[model samples]
Target: MTPLYQVSDSPAVVSKKYFSRRELMPSQNSSVWQIQSGSVRTMTYLDDGTIVTLGIWGAGDIVGSALSTIEPHIIECLSAVEAVALPLDRQNKMVEALAAHVEQAEELMVIRSYRTVDSMLLKLLGWLAKRFGRTVDNGQLIDLRLTNQDVAEILCSTRVTVSRVLTQFEDQGIIQRLPLHRIVLCNQETLRRAG
Candidate 1:
C-alpha cells in the first residue's frame, strides 16, 4: 500500500492520527475522516437493536461519525488505520470534503438497490475490482482483507449466507480465495456478465 505521507496535497492531514483494530473513532457529531491507509467500517443500529453497516471505507475514502443527517452511527477501525480527522468544528470543509465523494456515494446506492443478493454481491465485486483490485497472472487480486462477516454487513446479509454464496462462486470458478482474507477474481468477465 502507498504510504499516506506520500500524498502531496492533502492539507486536511494535519491531524494525522492512528487507530488500533476495532477501535471506535469519535461518532457523536458530524465530522469527516480522511483515510490515509487501512480501512474503517461505519454502522448504525436499527429499531430492534440490529446492527446495519453503512459502509467499509478504504484508502482515499471519506467517512463521518454520522454521515446521514437522519441517524447517528458509529465509525470503527476495521484494521489498524492512519487517518486525518477533519473535525467539522469550525469550517465548512466538511461540506467540501463530502462533495468530493458524491459520485462514489451514488455508485454505492445503485449497488445496494439491486433486487437480488447475488446480483448485488456480483456488482459489488465488480465495483471493488475497479476501485481496489489489481491484474495478476491468475486473475484480478483485490488487495483488501475483507472477511465474510464484513461482506455480510456491507451486503446486509448473514455471514452464513455470504460464506455460502462466496463458496458457490468459487465452485463456479468465478473467484478463488488466497491465503489470508484476500480474494482473487478468477473470472472477471463472467462476474461482469449480466445475470
Candidate 2:
C-alpha cells in the first residue's frame, strides 16, 4: 500500500522533496532501507556490554523512534527488515509529537518491565498475536516469519533456551509448527498460561 505521506505530496513537492516518496517519511530528511525477512544487521554496543534489541519492525511499524534523541541510532535490525532513516532533527520533532500521547508514554514503562528473557519472549508472542495474527479454522496463526535464533536475539537469550521453551510449548499443545516458517497457536489460553 502507498504511504499516506506519499499521496499527500504534490508533484512539485515530490520533485524537490528531500525525502523519497518510496520511503515512509516520518520527517523531512527520512531515508529508506529495505530488507527481506530473516536477515541480520549489526548494532551499536554500550560500555556496560548490554545489547539492546530495539524492535522487530514488521511491514507497517516504524523503527528508530526511541533512540532518535540522544544519539543518531540506538538499535539496529537483527533480521531482514525495512527501516526508514529519519534525520536527527526530524526524529526530535517526531518524538515531541509522540510524547503528548499518555498511552505512548505508558508503553515504554510496560516494555521496560519485561526484564527477563522468558518474559520478553512471552510478551513478544502476545504482541505478534495482536499485530499479525490471522484467524483460521483452529486458532490464530502468527504471520511473522521467525526462527528460534531470531527469538533469541529479541528475548536476549541463547537459541538453545528458546528452542527448549518452544519445544515445551509444543509438547503442551499450546502451539504447533507449520510448514513454510509459520507457527499456529493451537490454544490461546494454554499459551498465555505457559507465558
Candidate 3:
C-alpha cells in the first residue's frame, strides 16, 4: 500500500484531501479515507456493465476499495468532499464500517423490493431523510444535492421514472423540491400515510 502522506523530520500531521463532486476517489490497498464532510457512494460494475451502488457514506464514515472484495470497486464523491486517509489497522473500526455497509445494503434491498416504483421511491426518500436529513421548520430537509439520475442509480431504476415520481410527489404535497437538488419531506405523518 502506498502511503498517501509524505513523512518529514517534523511532527506528524495528517492532511485533508479535497474532492469535487462526481470525482472518483483513489483506492488504497492498506488504508481507507475517512470523510470529514460531504458524502460518497461506493460502487462496482456487473458482468453486463450494469452499475451497482454498494453504499452511500457521509461524514465520519470510512471508505476504501481495500475493504471490499468486489472487483472494480470505486468510491465517487456525491458532493464537495474533504477526507483524510487513515491506516486500516484498527479491527473494531473496520467491523463497524462493514456492519453499517451490510445494514444499509439490506435496507436498500427491501426498498427496491416494493411492487411499484412510487412505493420504492417513497421509501427511499424516507430512508434518506432519516439518514442524512436535518430538522427544518416544516420537516426533514435532505440536501445531498443528488440529481434524479443519481437517485435512479441508487434505486436501480430509470432516471425518467425517478423524475416523474419526484414531480408527482411535489404535486401531491408529499415533498417540496428546492434548488440544488434539495428536498424537504412534508412530515413523518405524511410519509407514513403515503406508505
Winning model by lDDT = 3
TM-score, structure 2 vs. true: 0.42
Which sections of candidate 3 miss by over 4 Å?
A: 1-91, 193-195
All candidates: TM-score: 0.49, 0.42, 0.52
The CA lDDT of each predicted structure is 0.71, 0.50, 0.80
Which regions of candidate 2 are displaced past 4 Å?
A: 1-116, 191-195
Residue-level lDDT tens digits of model 3 in 1-195: 533323333324455799999999999866788899999998876444667787899998878876665567789999999998766553466555764676577567656766678887888888888889898988889879999999999889899999999999999888999999999999879657433
What tens digits encode model 1's per-residue C-alpha lDDT throughout 102-156?
5366456656666667777777787787788899887778889899999888888
For residue 1, what is the lDDT in candidate 1? 40
Pairs that collide in candidate 1 are none
lDDT of 1 at 107: 55
Off by over 4 Å in 1: 1-100
